[model samples]
Target chain A: MTNIIWGPMIVLYSFITGLVLGSYIISIAPTLFKMRNLEGISTFSMVTAWGFLLASPIPLVLELGSPLRAPNIYLYPTPSSVMALFGYIWIIFVLLLTTQIIIHSRYRDAAWFQRASTGISAIGLVISLIFGGYFGFIIGSMKAREVWSSTITPITTILSGITAGAALVALLAIITLRKDGLRKDALNSLGKLTLYFLAIYLVFTLIELSTTAYAETLTWTRLSILLIGYLALSFIGVQYILGGLIPIFMLATEKVRTSTIGSIVAFILILAGVYSYKWNLIIGGQQIVEVSPQLYSLLNFMPTQTEILATVGILSLSLFLYVLGLTIFPIPEFKSKR
Target chain B: MSKYLKLQEELPHIVGRYIDKKSAKPKWVMVVDLNRCVGCYACQVSCKMENGTPYEFFRTWVEVIERGKYPYLRRVFLPRLCNHCETPSCVPVCPVGATYKRDDGIVVIDYDRCIGCGYCIQACPYDARFRNPYTGTADKCDYCLHKIEEGEVPSCVINCMGGARIFGDINHPESIVSKMLAEKSVSVIKPETGNSPSVYYIGYEEAVKAGAPVTVINPKIGVVKEI
Candidate 1:
């Protein structure tokens, strides 16, 4: 219940979200472009990919009591600790293997490069599903937190990540389009994906809220806030209505099709909507009070200034790596760049 | 080289050794007689002083629970501590091997290696474990192993003015725990969990049979409900 821990929690969330974003991009990258695309695609893919590799390990390491002691998790595992098990294999299979894909891609169409990216992408998808589900499992397993204790939490969290990844790629597509040349049809494709992900996110959010509203407990004030308080307004109102609907409506408009201020506004909304959704889930989940008298006191606790500064420090690290990743391996645009 | 000659030589040493060492020591276990417990929580206080635990942080805890309806209310006090189970759940779940079950069946934590992840705290079904907020690692009762090593009783048992607690090893044939084990029927907490706890309670089955303080049905359902 120490407020200072929230700083690490933020680091934990942003890293996992970044990892989810990277995994999803790799999964759909092939279909994203038609003609041997190599420009902006490679840039963000490499950036987010390497970002994910670095990001996912940070929380697991920091969460450990003794960093050296962590080796025992893989050595003599309890088997009940599935997260520790999956995390060990995940760090090996997803990040390390994916790096090989980047290495061989430099040869461009060399048999190894194509085979590695395709194979690693497949492995990344599977590992991401397990590792991503684990993030939700940890929250849900807390019997003390009834709102988070539901089995569906893992599913909802997984869905949110995919939705964020798809929306992000769509936004990136819009940004890259503005800088260089563009096909009106490519924008339409991004517009289509943006709409698809929005629908999925909305459905899942509704199902979770509707079910929770019935069997809710007083201990679950955090969930109540996410559903009824100011944050809930953003989650359902901006995220579901304005954030999601506005993008779909703009995509349908003739002005958006022709590329105007309408397109820029829609892209910005998607970005805001996604980031806000992430913030609400991470911060909102922690605000709940456990019913124990011991923990009740912790519920009224406030964050000290040091905690805020630590959070800023963690965010700075993520940002710096992301920028470095962009510089080294820019996403691909068209055929000739490779 | 004759078998009868060698047997004769060994017999004197064996009998002499038995005569010298017999009843020379006592093995100790903590036995709580709950029927005599008044829920004063003096034991909880003594446990704190012995362990020097942080304020509101505990190695041993007690709960006073309500049962039945308002007018028919029955309040019962149950003092809870680490079972120090023969087969401990906390021992294996420690990713760093920080928790270990000793040969004598006491479960102990290696604070130096425990990284404060609180994983073991979550795994304990009896809520026997607590995360030491300052250290961020799991903490729990060790059956007062340090005191036992020093030939002293656990502070809680010594402080129990009602003499509700008895401490001795159940292993020695003539020890008080072994005598009680033979002559009386008693129970270990959550026997169904297969933890094979070292702490024994007299008159528990009677309390349970009367449906007193806590009714842990089928006490063996030690499935992954908590951890």
Candidate 2:
């Protein structure tokens, strides 16, 4: 068996990609779904999504041994490689997002712009969804990694993205706007939506675990590592308890769902939980001992200090971009009628 | 002509080997005789020396599986390396086309072209590939390409104490490997993966079917350690 190759940066990249997709999904509620309550944070979510989308590839590039040769993905793309599609997908997403944001911010009054923005927003939404699924496909296509080789992986990942994305919108709505922010009804609605996604995410997580339990092949070794081995703490504690149950209870209760502090706490847990899920999936899948005669032992694969710092640095830069975006873009007033 | 030293004038007849170009290119194959293996890992050591692989990594490794309890106990030495598969799973998964099959059927990675994304490493069912920490590229056993070019055996083949490692071109009708394949039963590892590995094992059915759990025996203390 080989030592662990992928580090924390890869995990961070997947989490950040989900955020990009999730934020875009939240932005869709107002523009495409035409939910009036969601209108308050539609522009905010779009800008945030763009910030995350732009930052998504930075971690990937940083993780590469030869970052300069990354363009080879486009230069000599193998048709069968799912990772090769990353270049084209990122470009398409950026272009559609740029057009959609411009139409919404600059020409909100023009009927033609509204129609165009709606169409463009729909396209952006589809791209974001596929972008979310693309992260899943990247790992799921690796048939050798038994823990990740399943069709349900894509579905579970998309659901997890939705949960995190909706929670981000709700958290931002509460924190930025405060008392004079979005209506009580809108906040509560967001709370309920986040809860539903979290529930479904939990179900998919169970299904993933259960399927692994029944496998008769060497894949069962991976399942044992996840459940009873070193990874059990992260899977059961951080993901299920801190991320899942606690947040579900918080959002399910009407009093907490309606309260700003309570909802923020819940959203924070949701984000932690979802990120932990990704951490477990990416890192855990790779940590399994390859079939070796010396009795393959799992490595204590932790990211280096440099890798940790780089991850934090990229996230900080992404946040900085989001803050800069909020300043430059004149996002419509929260819940204000046009 | 200008009183220059001519080294050619000093040396006598040292006839070089003549390889026929008219014959078809030889398709290389390795046959591991499981019955002869002693699980000493001499080949593993020689391979690392030949390749200069990192400390934590291996170009070829030995798996010594211990099966059953006390009275019925048995051990199997399973030396593993890159299958050099015909339909290698790692080939297409490489985003930059760094990994490809040669005309002679060896699966090789071009270090110059590999971006070190480690995709092919994960795609391999045998866990034969690795991201070399020093080079930052995907690496695996290429059946000792340098030695093959020199018309010599692989380092592992030369080092095997039990004479379990056999390397030859299976395409040649007169080759020992071709004779063994025709006369004896052999099997490849993880054939269900559909990788069609070129490496075959003689008398491997029992060990392969056992799927026994193994433990590491600390070389110094000779203590069996559980992981």
Among the numbered candidates, top lDDT falls to 2
Which ten-residue region of model 2 chain A has the weakest summed lDDT? A289-298
TM-score: model 1 vs. ground truth: 0.70
Instruction: Report the lDDT tens digits of candidate 1 across residue range A156-218.
Output: 667666655555554555564456555565555555555666566667766766676566533
DockQ of each: 0.15, 0.42
TM-score of model 1 (first chain only): 0.73
lDDT of 1: 0.58
Best by DockQ: 2
What docking grade applies to model 1?
incorrect
Question: Per-residue lDDT of A1-338 in model 2, one digit per residue for the tens?
Answer: 35666778888888888888888888878778877777777788888888888898999988887778888888897888878878888999988887777777778889697778778877887888889888798776667776678777888889999898888778877876674457788888888889999999999989877775666433455566767889888988889999999999888998999997899999999999998999999988777655533244465777789988998899888878877776777777543532
Model 2 stretches with alpha carbons more than 4 Å out: A217-224, A290-296, A334-338, B1-23, B211-227
Among all windows of 10 consecutive residues in model 1 chain B, the one with the lowest summed lDDT is B218-227
Clashing pairs in 2: A293-B63
